[model samples]
Target: MGVASKLKDGFLSAFCLFLIGGAGFVVNVGQLLALVILPFDRHLFRSISTWLGSGFMIAGPFLLEDWGGCKFSAYGEQAPPDSKVLIVVNHGTDMDWAGGLSYLARLGEPFPGGAKAIAKDTLMYIPIFGWLTYFLEFMYVKRDWESDKKTLTKQANQLGTSRLPFYLCLFPEGTRKTPKKHAQSQEFCKKNGYPVLNNLLYPRFKAFTLIAMTMRDQIDGVIDATFAFEGEHPNMSKSLSRKLSCRCNLICQYHPMNELPEGEEELEEWLRNTWVKKDALLDEVLKDQEAFCSKQRKYEWKQEPLDYTKFFALVGVFCFFLVGLSVLMIVNKIIRRGVLVISVITWVAVVAALVINIRPSKVGEKKPDPETSSRRKKAD
Candidate 1:
């Protein structure tokens, strides 16, 4: 493509991204208001969340598929929506997660509903987007094992026992692949007497180890999502603009947790071997995209046809909010920002305090009957 065409596509891609993102920001405002339902009725809170969060994310796929003309071919067995999944992807380009959402839509998994991802702690500080993710139940970590271990344990416990089924997506690579990071990975491998990977970084096994052990019994499926693009991996601009004939194909595999060896050391060894396998998969697909996209497989998952009604309704809701909030913020800047900020801050502080203070129920510990407690108090 010529430079002019590239520039035009980039401009258009960015504009569309903002439109969708803007709509999402507006929806976050509604999520903010919906916090009242959370304390009184957990079921209603989840129902509201499905629309405000996951329902809003449906636009991501529509923007890519309808506007950008990108097609994602998915291959694997995905757990039913009612079942629990732990997905570890070989994180590649910037849009990997977004594109994967297209495939998740195909597999009948919740878009971002109960589909929780581990995000950087920094994301929580962003005004609208940050507040939205916090309400969506995203887990944040700073990558320090000391503090992160506690955060993971505390958060995982909530999902571990919930009747709501969730698909927890993780990137064991810890971060995306880049020239500098790849060099570091290579040096670390050499120092540690491990084989160097040509296509993937050495897996960081800490978070995965802890998460897997904690949710092992509840986990229904462990998925490995391997992605390869037809051309050089693209950022949101190129990917959204569908430049370079950029196409993504994901070949996912399901492994039952009980089938794998249960020990931590054994699990680490299994992960080492898994990365070696992913390296080979990447090497294969780089040579031929057809290696996976067109190949026959045990399961062939089709993309769920775009939900135009839900998509437009979500975008429309935001558009409405945009106009209303614009005037409200302008007319009442002090009151608007003050109320929004205080509500979010107080809610976050309270939740953090509760998570820190709450203790997990002890296994096999008998609970005192409520009636008995009341009777004993009366006698006392």
Candidate 2:
């Protein structure tokens, strides 16, 4: 596709994704307010919010596939709906998680408890998307061993007690692989006498180790997924742009958790070894892309098309509640003036804060400290 065509497609796809996200944000705020005043089980409300919020978020990926002309192909056994899965994948592009989710949704069945990502704490602070993710109960880590250890433990305990089945998605590489980072990874590998990987960074074992130890009994399997895109070097913007024929090859290999080693140290070793095998697999694919693509096991999903009928209905209900709340506040004479004044002040404050926080950094500004950058990349 030409540059102009590509830009048009990208804009259209992004706009659609934004609309879906905006709807989700509205639903989240409405539900949160309801939970404060309504007499309902908090857990039940939380589950409902998560399901609705995730549904909204997942819609973006599917829409991207339809609108952006991105093709997805998956190879390997599909995780059963009842199973609690841990999805560990190499991080190459920002859209890796989105593409993975789209592929999973295409499977003939839905995951038992919906999937949640282990994101960086920074993501939880980004306006609408972040707020919605927080409402959905996604686990956000600071990437510091001292901090994340406690966070992961608490998350594990909560998941263990929850009735819903979950697919916990983790990117063990910790950050996206860039040329500079790749060089650093190769240097570390050489010093440690490990095979240098071209496509993947060395997997960080700390988070995986802690999670495995805490949730060993609860998880059913581990899905090791390697995502690759065709053509020249691909990144998030390119993936979303329809100018190039983007074909995503997602190879997923599922290993039963029971088959993995039990001891913490042994399990960490096993995980690292798995990454070595992944590097080898990526190398083989890179060497002969056509052969690898032709050999992948392809299956048609026999599921119904994604339905937004229920989502629209729920949105209407929330809108009605909000309208009623507004009317009630206005009709009460004693508090009406006070409420209006307070609402105006609150709106102004919120807008000012968002403007300051979302503003772009000045050109030629000094880069953030390494520690801050590291933490941001962990979440990115």
Candidate 3:
């Protein structure tokens, strides 16, 4: 966090943005090529696009190196490889979902195949990315409440039909992670005399119950991925961009998302109870960290060569390179007439990803919360 480090970090951030944009351009062209040449299986395309996105996700940490002290650990029974899971996680930053996916890759899980997320519709309209992912069949939701409910119902049905093992990652808190929200969550849990460590931002459960009930038959289990960032302060996410380079850890414990009850009221109660236990488990993890040895036990971390996969790794790199060059030329020569320095810088990133052809991964916030809302308010 020194001045030099801050300057270095700023440069890196700008570089990452350029690379992200360049990557998007390349990925778009790649998807288009796949669509035209790869016979006509919509399923195959979706799978490939998803895996491609995962690859981009994997490349992010290395290229950006914004996350510091990042870790992903699991609890309860680990889902069988390729099993469909409904993953419930505490959302802490805009990057939390992506961070979680990267974390999953480290845990030796098939990050892409098992992943499908509910995203805002507006995001789908964002140039290359939004279009390609939308075409590939990611779930898109309107910002309104009623529409989101209907969309959740539809997503459940889609999950049942899609046969591809899928896990839905939802931020029941429905927003970025913040200390105030975390403290509020803690207060709610304590006032109800519920377990204190299941401390999370207040979870809005309307759609959660629906998704669980709809996909009950297909879902192998419900994963409560409690993400805890170990640091010295409670306002971990307020300045989330700052923690990307500091030490951070995430404890993701998976518990069986029990069978959804038949009655609506019972189901709500069931979901609430499930969260209460999650709170306690979160507390247990936090306490253990406080008392544990300096040399913490290293959870499983695995990496494999991407080229082993069917054509994906090779094709993705080629596409990244091609797209980078094309964008650089277009922006420098035709579109911006070389006036936009940002565009020129982004092109360089695409070139780097192609030349290096390396990918690294991890997940979650990089700071610690000192107290939940209930505790913080009292201390003040």
Evaluated at residue 157, the lDDT of candidate 3 is: 86
- Descending-lDDT candidate ranking: 1, 2, 3
Report the Cα lDDT for candidate 1: 0.72
The per-candidate count of clashes, in order, stands at 0, 2, 15
| Better candidate number, 2 or 3, judged by TM-score | 2
Candidate number with greatest TM-score: 1
Candidate 1 lDDT over residue span 1-380, tens digit each: 89999888878866675666666666687787888988897667766776567666666566656666666667766655577888888877666767767766654435555667886676676655567767777789986789999999898887676666677888888777777778778888999999799998899888888888888888886888888777656465555576535566787888887776777888888888988998998877766767655663446665557664655676677678668877887789796888689768955764464343222212122468999999999999
- Per-residue lDDT of candidate 3, residues 207-240 (tens digit): 6777777877777787766665555422223222
TM-score of each: 0.79, 0.76, 0.68
Q: Pick the candidate with the highest lDDT.
A: 1
Among residues 3 or more apart in sequence or in different chains, the pairs in candidate 2 whose N, CA or C atoms overlap within 3 Å are 113-165, 120-379
Ten-residue region with minimum lDDT total, candidate 3: 356-365
Q: What is candidate 1's CA lDDT for residue 336?
A: 86
Cα RMSD (angstroms) for every candidate in the order listed: 14.1, 7.2, 9.1
TM-score of 1: 0.79
